[model samples]
Target: DTAVSQTPKYLVTQMGNDKSIKCEQNLGHDTMYWYKQDSKKFLKIMFSYNNKELIINETVPNRFSPKSPDKAHLNLHINSLELGDSAVYFCASSQGGQGGDTQYFGPGTRLTVL
Candidate 1:
């Protein structure tokens, strides 16, 4: 079974549109995170949720929002998507949100904004 999974493996939309990516983890982890990888492959942390509470929220545009309905699910909703939003979004989970804890990553959702 896949420990972590995301819906819509590929997403293509026009600028100014809105979209959402859903993520779920079956590993029973308490902490979940959202990371964005740009075309150059530079990964940056966007948001982190622990036990359904917002923990670490990086400096991202207000257009980007992370919602956690429960411990097992974290969803990313983007509003007014722009060209810069084109990238691969990854969902990850760790046991305690510690630096040394191993993180399990989803396949990633590739978003392309035209």
Candidate 2:
């Protein structure tokens, strides 16, 4: 009975390889987001989707992509993974833009590139 869940909590790979992380939520939220936490512990929003349409897109590389199958699930896919991509990826969701609504985050998927 998890509110949010991310697959392969730990990911280890080499540079130039492709990988993906899956996320799901049972909170019945309409907005989902992807965030990356760097080694310095800087949390930055990468993408946000509402009803399967992209609502927010930060200055992320083209190698990164996000897909929302439904309002309850959002998956992230990365191509040509680079060392710079080694970071903790988080999946979060909110109940829409409800006046500074707080988002719930998953445990996080730690990607380590060699």
Candidate 3:
């Protein structure tokens, strides 16, 4: 069984469009996160959910929203997609919401905005 899974692994859309990516994990982790990998390959945490409570990274834009229905799922919704938003979005999960815990990542969702 896959520890983590994401739907629509690739997304191609025009700017100003809205899109959402769904992620599910069977790892039974307490914390799940949404990370955005920029074109330069810099990965930054956008949001994290611990036990269904959200903790948004301050640097992330208000347009980016993360929702966790339960401990095993985290979904990302992007409003008014921008060209700069094109990057690989990774969904990750860790046993505990702490810095040293191993985070297992799912196959990235590559979003390309034209």
Candidate 4:
């Protein structure tokens, strides 16, 4: 079984369309996070949840939301998608909500806004 899985690995849509990417982890971790990697391969943390509670919000736009139904699942929703939003969204999990914890990342969902 996959430790971390994400649905719809590739998403192609218009600039104004809304889209969502779902993620699930079987690692039984209590912390999950969402990261965006731009075309230049710059990675940035968008959101993080620990025990189903928001722990980090890195100046992300209001249109971007991260929802964790439980400790093992984290989904990302983007409203009014823009060209800048086109990037690889990665789902990750760690043993706990700590800076030194090793994070396992999903394959990532590539979003393209045309």
- Candidate maximizing TM-score: 1
> Model 3, clash count?
0
Write the residue-wise lDDT of candidate 4 on 1-114 in tens digits.
999999989999999888999999999999999999999999999999999999999999999988988888999999999998989999999999877989999999999999
Tens-digit lDDT track of model 3 for 1-114? 999999879999999999999999998899999988998999988888889998657488878888888888899999999999999999999998887999999999999999
Model 3 TM-score, 2 decimals = 0.95
Q: Residue 45 in model 4: shift from native, Å?
A: 0.6
- Clash pairs, candidate 1, are none
TM-score of each: 0.98, 0.97, 0.95, 0.97
Residue by residue across 28-96, what tens digits does model 2's lDDT show?
989999999999999999999988889989999989999998989999999999999999999999989
RMSD of each: 0.6, 0.8, 1.0, 0.8
Model 2 residue 112 CA deviation (Å) reads 0.3
- Model 2, global lDDT: 0.94
Give the candidate order by descending lDDT: 1, 4, 2, 3
Assess the local accuracy of residue 93 in candidate 4 as a C-alpha lDDT between 0 and 100: 94
Q: What residue runs in model 1 are displaced by over 4 Å at the alpha carbon?
A: none
In every candidate, how many clashes are there? 0, 0, 0, 0
Q: Model 2: runs farther than 4 Å from truth? A: none
